[model samples]
Target chain A: MFKKILFICLLPLVASAQETIYDSFVLAPGWTKLSFIPPESGTYTLPTYPKATNGNVINHKSEVKSLYQLYDNKITLLNFMYTTCTDINGCPLATAVFHKIQQKVSKDPVLSKKIRLLSLSFDPKNDTPDVLKLYATGTDKQLVDWQFLTSSSPELLDPILRGYQQRIVKEYDENGNYIGSISHILRVFLIDQEKNVRNIYSVSFLHPDLLINDIKTLLDPKTKNGTVIARSAN
Target chain B: MKKLISTLYGMLMSAFLAVALVPTQAFSDETCMSPYMAKIVGQEDYVYVWTLGQVGVGDEQDKLVTIAVNPNSPHYGNVIGHVSVGGRNEAHHSGFTDDRHYLWAATLDTSKIFIFDVHTNPNKPKLHKVITNFVKASGGIVGPHTTYALPGRMMISGLSNNQDFGGRTALVEYTNDGTYVATYHMPHDENLYGATKTGQIADGYGYDVRALPRRNVMITSSFTGWNNYMMNLGKLMGDSDAMKRFGNTVVVWDLHSRKPKKVFDVPGAPLEIRCAWGSQNNYCFTTTALTSQIWLIYEKDGEWQTESVGTIGDPAKIPLPVDISITADDKHLWVNTWNDGMTRVFDISDPHNAKEVYTKVIGDQVNMLSQSWDGKRVYFTSSLLANWDKADGPEKMPQFFKAYDYKDGELQFKFAIDFATEKLGMPHQMRFGAYSLYAKSPKDGAKVAELSK
Candidate 1:
């Protein structure tokens, strides 16, 4: 009953305008079969790319919180997205992949306790706290902690967007009116407990299997010292 | 007016969709940029050329030269802006970050990388950052050749090492903000670096690096090191010992783990690696400098394999195939032979058999080629190296930046900017810039009109 209600509520968000956009192009590999086998967890290392920046965000429950607070020493998968993103390969792909990660973690208690998935919206004007609340309905039942967050205004969101280097361009109509649509390259960041970004995944690299492998690699005890095993020179 | 508005609307919609929805490796502006970066789907406003400073040239300083390219713009076909970075550093190649906001131009001699902010003002690009510790930070990696974008980071291929200044080197990774991440050394005969030697040779020399993210593969081609590349071209060619230093292998890597998987013996210094744009194509092409043969690296029966597909012009002549660009459709390839001053188009429709379809003499010496997304407008530059550049007389090298319109199976001359005659330096690599990338429109008023006039 809960799943049906949640699906019904989310249908309108993706049905009319979004379905037309999504149907025009093929789905990204994250939605289909991953063409290549990902490297096994704990076998390879994910070097720290950049430091994940912290910003003020409003959660779906309308509570003000620092992004670092949500991180809370957990291995975080931070994704920038909006609720009404119509592109199948853009925000929808990130969200769907995150959903799969949540499902996989729900079955494994060890990973459930250590993982945090964040879907932060770049379009704060459209994706308000209340809207995200409704959009995030039924996520609480998942074992892994999943947070759908939005900012109160552009002022509060711009810093986080800039820090992550998430470039987005707002679409305009023929008469130069704001169309409530933002175009952005889909980027999902995997941040370690130290707030250092380990890896960034775009549409081609984003997949549940790869994400889980990276998460496990980060959680591996050998990697706790932040030392990557030197690749065999021979 | 209605037709104009409808056409404008159609263009705007197309641009929005292209920027919003296109996946990696789907569409690109220059047809050879990193798939991780955003592409200019419509008209590009500027072509930022990383130029090498000639000794007696106007500034005698390596500079980033910006040429206005949009035909609709008033200042089209003109050198509108330039920013010279102090001194000469053998400006060879430049690439944009994944966000398409910054351009990283590297120098082979100094191992210095100048990052330009192309987004703030596309016309007049400002130097954002200079990475001075590349050699030290990368642990002796020198001559950063190709600055490739991978997700949020830049992967730089090294031509030489500080220890010997020879061919053996490694690929260094850095964050977009110029923070060094890690280095993965190329596999040689003594140390395969966990990569299997499919062929006898496993020379770990490095030149260009490219990735096919869908296949989880990154490919690196090999070229000679600083000892030979910086030496006088005539002298180095005459000296057999220096000539023997040229790379003879191309290494295939696992993109995710940054590890070498296989090394294929592609004798004779493969300069550029251009992979097909089609999602299912799953193949890349490279041409040798000494052998003048086109080689195809493809996957067969779940194993990556390589074979000599076709010959460029004549191996006997040593045309010195330098750079190559593949069209977005993956049907045609533009190969630039620096020695013969010719740009050859190959019908790569059959990947296994690349037949030369057409040829055009670009200039006295052409080193680089960059084509537009539609493969309509092709751009060429004529500088290979400061020491190796061809010159009929002292200070008389025919360095130029030429633009051509490719339509109906032939190249129509559009315009040419003689770098030497204009007192500018030798222009090497050209990267496109646009105002639409940053959601800004071209400036309006008399300045643009006057510049155009």
Candidate 2:
């Protein structure tokens, strides 16, 4: 019986293993953007971005403004990053992707008029309004519309982070000594004109083209009761 | 005329050779392949076995034991290589990058993540780097349980938090190259699932995460932290306060945003999660370790819902359904009962009406279950929690890996490799490696490298 079982086990080895075709940007190089259709049944849709609870944000010009009011009936792509982030794939990647998106949208009249990007610095102390203004004013003229916002202090940013459910913790050593920096997940929220979060892009999926496709989907007109209802041109 | 005929004959011979060299389909279609996905497919050269030394006896730390898996190889069924990462940090689930180059393994206690460069050599895997400051980096989240790949990064779910160290936990993300990215906390305060009137499941220790990227949705199951799991089994059962420690909820997140969209109450510690194979099947299954039941998460008409699909063993005895593995066709599910030492196979062709098909005992204690790409072979490992693993059972034997042959709805035990006998420790997650390590000679089916005399 043991011999028979061993023989049977060896049978699978004689057979070929499963083929795994991974989804990658390289594999599907021609996929500039995705064309999605609302499913008829058993579908999943992202929840609308909740209204920004903590409205206290200081813009680059040092003016107090509500974070939610910045949406201003526009498609907002909001992300949190510090100016000093050195990780190539962390804050730097997000900033680069935002710049690419800005450059792409500037060419498309529909996207340029409808979408707005927000980069909020969670390190409020170091990234003051003046620092944010300096950080936003890069040589790239294409990023003119992108706004850099920050709070007055870590305390003021707490409610905003909590509302967004962004888990940010200060690093410490095994000896319990402070590491002087914060650890956080990179989440870029894509909010619609109605203040609903349509999607959140992480490091891997945070491509300019993918963001543009999602933006177009949200901008596309909806059919209600067999009538073509045009979305608000915000 | 003779020269023309010779040229035509040579072209025909070359065409025949090319056609014969192509690999034919001889394996069953199995899709979900992450940590276990080998770049070269069926010819898995090495098996990277996560082993824990005799921690209960204070003799060993957790390590990675590489065994030649190619049956025809000379080193087959032998421990040819090992990596001893000192400290018994309760090494659990591991995953591989999408490119199948690096293997990310984590320890629960210290949250120390070890990335092994499996591509360098299938047999001798080198420790590329280590993420040492997970606790400080992930803000108070401790105990990294599951390591899963998402594009170019690895998404890890924690089983405990530093503040309470009971159940409150968070899910963290990091670049595959060991850079800290961000964190998403599971729902603990409000009713995420809206199950009961209060809508609060209390504990939020995250155990497993599975996502449907196309649907832009991901689901996470909950398990208790190390402290709760390592507590005296009898004391934990008797203590009413301790009974409330295990997580009883599953949260669904927007995959793109990493935000919790829905939280459903799955009572009694849901451990392993296996999503169905295809994009059309917008459903996944998770086993409740404490309750001995299998729960199903499905989306209907754009709304998400969860339900108790089926029960695994006698709930009264708490058989402890610890690990779950699904077939490539999404027709069957293999669930391992840690306490009872039995692997139960369920026919999941119909999500709602699942039936138990087969059952077999592999050892005194069984925890993790990994299936081959073809779904024809199922691998079983014995060891759940060091202290909780059959501590008081009749037979306190060594932990081993039992390979079974699944044919026609039955699981027949084929062979067993004893890890405990060699004191190599307890094997947890078993992943496949590249075919180059175990390539066999075509003539006599001999492995290229000869084993040491």
Candidate 3:
């Protein structure tokens, strides 16, 4: 019996065991940076920057229910975020950026005429529409023009984020505590009036003037733009 | 014309060799071929390597998955022709009968034993039977964590749960065909243990069931001793009162003598204890599922001397530390830790500082671990206890194996042990060598070097 077993087991051994392939890379920091890994360890990879899903809207918050009765046929600025996020890079930064975008867009008459701001929360738990409405509008100004939406679960949040090609995963300690590592897909989507995601702006490129130019090109097709999203003017 | 014919023949021969060797070498070299890998298996030469079929975790179809490899392929190791053992859940253990005939496994999801035949293979191997129901009537307890096969007679087993809490590590017996014979409830002092709310009382399914030179002793270490001093939870120590109630004691049951021995207790909880013939008498070495530290326990100077030697994490791709086996040579100690992502090897020649010489990541999450007679290549299976997706679930696809080059710390190969068409369920425990093919010359393994030089 043993001899028969050994004979049967040895059949696959004449394989030429050579050739090397290395699939190694550094674990980049943060999730939206598209470098989030599994609950376990190993290198993190962000899927191809997801093309944004536009024109879809639902009311997830209360007071902000009718915040903006009319959304001008303007280009929408898209940002993904989540609540229960304590890290500066997670939900806080996305909201803060949208807050800044709201201020900047409100001032630019020509830009505001054709563009809006959208901030979706990856964390559906804490960030109800009311909470998001409270969050988007700082103490001074209620950035009611910007919409903050939360999905039902990680399952729902996953596709929206992955659609926008964003990455996120729960962070844990040596003892397995669920420390939040909520993050966004760092790039802001510049969707045109057609609800088509047109331009990609890395997080660092989110300056107001630069964004103004990009919107100008998307809206008018011909104009003098800036460093973030500039047009040829021709 | 003659020259042309010879050339054509040579070309045909080379083409035949290329097609046959590519995939064979490809997977092996990628997963288990580094020179450093051989050292991990701790064997001079590998006799056999067979990848298994797909087996799901209990209810969880995803997560836990594995490929079983019998590197030392028994002297008579390939009898079943195409049947072997493997699974989807990681961090489980196994029970094999002597002579490598019957193999039994405890799954992570259902906490039941799955059985298989080792002789069922020529190249492709798989499991023939699964005894999903391992429950016996014993004081309202069910769910077993580990199993031990005593050849064709009856096998021993341990229980893991109750309605409110898990029950004692009750020892049970099973017939050769994977039938539950009877359960041997362990001796526990409820007064000392308290009522179990989730095995929260004073005990749990036994951890390690080992046979020593003198007799059989199954060691039980409450679950609380396994995780970060039970750090993740709000409380310290372990999950329930049963584990804490036991006070981190090593519960030993001598099956032969029918005697129970609470030999030693660590300041920390000890989950699993294995007894091997050390240079001294049967020296029992144990790892604290609680501390990640290994302890050397032996009776000396009229008392048990427990010495701290080394440290290791959970099994590769698994969530908790589990079944461990010391090589026949005892020079190498192999441990399967929880969610650790790799199988660790310790050179115990110097037990004082048992250096981690090498490691090999097993498939998905590792449940139980097994070894070829030579101990060069180690085999691991999956279990659902460590959050392994239960068997028959959608997520339980693409399960494979973890082969290490014993010499180099690298994966020798990872083959899809999953055979899609057969619909093989979760793999559990395994034993190698149902048939052994003799060498043509029958030369001594040591003669190659002497004769050549």
**Model-by-model lDDT, in order?**
0.84, 0.68, 0.43
TM-score of the A chain in candidate 3: the value is 0.60
Question: What CAPRI-style quality would you assign to candidate 1?
Answer: acceptable
Better of 2 and 3 by TM-score: 2
Ranked by TM-score, top first: 1, 2, 3
lDDT of 2 at B178: 75
Q: Report the C-alpha lDDT of model 2 over A3-114, residue by residue, as the tens digit.
A: 3222222212211121121121111111123322222211222333334444688888899888768888888898988766543335655776776688678887756878
Clashing residue pairs in candidate 1 are none
Query: Which lDDT tens digits does candidate 3 get at residues B69-166?
Result: 33333321222233333343332455443323344555534444555443333123345576655553433344454554342223344444454344
Tell me the interface RMSD of every candidate, in Å. Answer: 10.9, 17.8, 27.7
Model 1 spans with C-alpha error above 4 angstroms: A1-4, A7-26, A225-234, B1-29, B393-395, B445-453
lDDT of 1 at A215: 89
Q: What is the lDDT of candidate 3?
A: 0.43
* Ranked by DockQ, top first: 1, 2, 3
> What DockQ does candidate 3 score?
0.00
Candidate numbers, best lDDT first, in rank order: 1, 2, 3
Give the candidate number with the greatest DockQ: 1
Candidate 3 clash total?
Answer: 140
